[model samples]
Target chain A: MTDKPRFKSARESGYLLCIDCEKLHPLSLEGELCDRCGARLHSRVPNSMNLSWASLIAAVILFLPANMLPIMTFKSFGQGEPSTILGGILHLLDQDMLLIGLVVLFASIVVPVLKIIAMTILLCTVQFRLQTNLRQKTLMFRIIEWIGRWSMLDIFVIGILVALVQLGNIAHIEGNDGATAFAVVVLLTMFSAIIFDTRLIWDNGVTDLPSDNSDEKDTP
Target chain B: MHGTPEQLIACHECDLLMTRVANKPNEDVICPRCHARIFYTSINSIERLLALSVAGLILFIPANIFPILSLQVFGQSQSEIILQSALSLFDGGLVLVALLILLFAIVVPLFQQVILFYISFTLHYRREGRLLRQAMHAYQHLRGWGMLEIFMLGVLISIIKLKDIADLHIGLGLYSLAALIVVTTLSSVFFNPHQIWHQIDLRRQKRATDDR
Candidate 1:
């Protein structure tokens, strides 16, 4: 409240104290907020880290089932039948799309699973109060979290096939239990990441510190 | 009526510093320096919002029931049921697509919508129930599973190619399924989860005071 600076709008009214000089500077209209003090006037989303982690966990869980279950049933000329996760990868191989097969295997199967495991470890470590490789874990988590949603390509393929391939009773497609489970797993992981509080990961270490006047004075 | 403190708030985009005050702006407030918007608690509604969400649940049944798509290749014609598609994919040895479709098209949507409705219903109508928070968390977890758009894309591609071969007929189920997608989207938009949580907190406080 001492030496409070005047501003145009309450929306714009906040103290922007520089970490280096410890002086208050008014926010600029050019960029986001004051660069020195990092005073933000507004926010984008709430608990983003929590949301990201929650989504990541849900994605990982879903990834497991997505690969384990049968995504779609293909009836071609009444001769085809349902395909499982590995079955589809093999089918791609059968279709001579080895590269696509591998890609699908890695993206839909490998990457997603790896991401889930990686995120789980990262989030769990932070959540459970065990922090060793915080930076590396966080970086890896970011990458996995970023690419997690794209793995839905396999699910998309199934949806496409189900929508198409309806040639009367001669050929048709259907979805099965496995597919539903897989989808749930994917969604669960996504939401897990979305709901998880990433900042909580950072908070476990500092929360136990003493809230004394000396500590408060040290910030200035 | 306690207000959130300044230190309690942070930038939504970058987690920078911000002062917390009661009744903050609802949307589109950016950080003056970083230009990052500082989003406080997201607008969330609880089981009460389920009243609005039931529409999505009702539409979901049709989304799954009717033929999502149909096609005719050459003189012969066929229809694809979601369940049958999974079976056929397994039979055809295209197991991956089969599994993928089941998960994205059927499982995820059903899970998300049902869970959401369940949570919202329990929270909104049944005031005395516990574990409402857990339900909200579960709903948030499952809501992303609905992969209607991705499924639609696959169907669209099939239609484009099938049209070259024979007459293509997309059924009422498919249209209803599409409408179901719209309904779910609208439900998410209209029902705010954070608001619901706030209401619950307020009620809890009021109840505690009354008990005291």
Candidate 2:
């Protein structure tokens, strides 16, 4: 005696809703503009996977240089040293600025890695149509989207440092290639997450009309 | 909850035909099929959003114009305001980084707050739905690009990193920058565009029924 309807989705009932305006139109009106808001109504975003894969692969490729090349160059008294992301963190740790060092470590290093890995897992789940953990996958996407932007912190810090630390023969900080690569990496990951429609993950599993949403089979 | 077919809302995350349900204040209505948060029923969404965005717009001015920090290196001292700090990168031959700073830290933040203020204010006074819709779209698209909070963290990290290299003094701009970051973040969390869209839906439906 469940109250839920047989049609699991508006798509199943041959309807597509405007995401912005929340107005439902028949699926046949796919290419037509939503009269209320003018957003082109589609049952689903076309080619969401292909674009997500492209952005993700590019981010993975750029992640190498983002970590390997020097992120910033600090020069003092005619001596210059270029430091990578990890090198900078080590330098801070060497100075016994443990708290700030950990902060940088989390934002610069951990967050990107976490975002890339999480995005990959999400893509695979949808790509293979893995029916399990559909809800968990959506939650993961939200977490990554919210935290993904914070990875820009390191580059902003470097920008300010490069701006403020110029002194002839005393101290100077220079911007480097790694900063650009890192910024690109962050941007690409953000693009990938945005392009991915989390709805696709449920298309494989949500067909069952009476499925309990809280399928805590994998909960700890 | 409205039972009209026009009231049917689809889940963007799962494509479920979610029934229209009354939203209790300070609660969330999530899609059952995918657990995507379909509605964040923030009470007084427009009023709260207006207050927060107004505070952010005010703070944005001083946060950009006032000197943020002054650094003493050997016998030389250089002071920087937020806007000039980003612009000065052009002189150092870091045009790309400079542009990034100007964009993510400067242009986007101002535009976002202004757009939010406009949308909330206009919607508050029952302005044209078409204009409010356009502003709403821009606000949504601009959400991901603004980085004032990240910029604040950068300011803190840069201050610490410079301690071993130079003497530093925090300025009014830094404090304003901190305050601006907080207000904008609160603006983002508390402002929900869904409420505006729902209001638009109500008007459209009422118009349809009245024409009958």
Q: Best DockQ goes to which candidate?
A: 2
All candidates: DockQ: 0.09, 0.49
Top TM-score prediction, candidate number = 2
lDDT of 1 by residue, A1-220 (tens): 3532211222123423221112233433323453322333222224555776656655555556666666667666667777787897897777676776776687567865786787668667866887564445655656765566656656566655654565556666676766666656665665566555444444444322132322221111
Provide i-RMS per model in Å.
12.7, 5.6
How does chain A of every candidate compare to the true chain A by TM-score? 0.62, 0.90
lDDT of 1 by residue, B1-212 (tens): 13223243443322334454454645544443224333334444453346546776787777667776666566665666556656666665556656666776778777777766765666566556466555555655455556676556546545643455468788777787778777667666655544555455566677789899
Candidate lDDT values, in order: 0.56, 0.82
lDDT of 2 at B24: 83
Candidate 1: where is the Cα deviation over 4 Å?
Answer: A1-151, A159-220, B1-7, B11-17, B22-25, B29-48, B90-100, B122-126
lDDT of candidate 2 over B1-212, digit per residue (tens)? 22227556777777887666777888887776666777778888889888988999999988988889999976799888877756766676667767878899999999999998998887787665567777877888788899988888888998888887679999899999999988888989987877777776677688689899
Best by the lDDT measure:
2
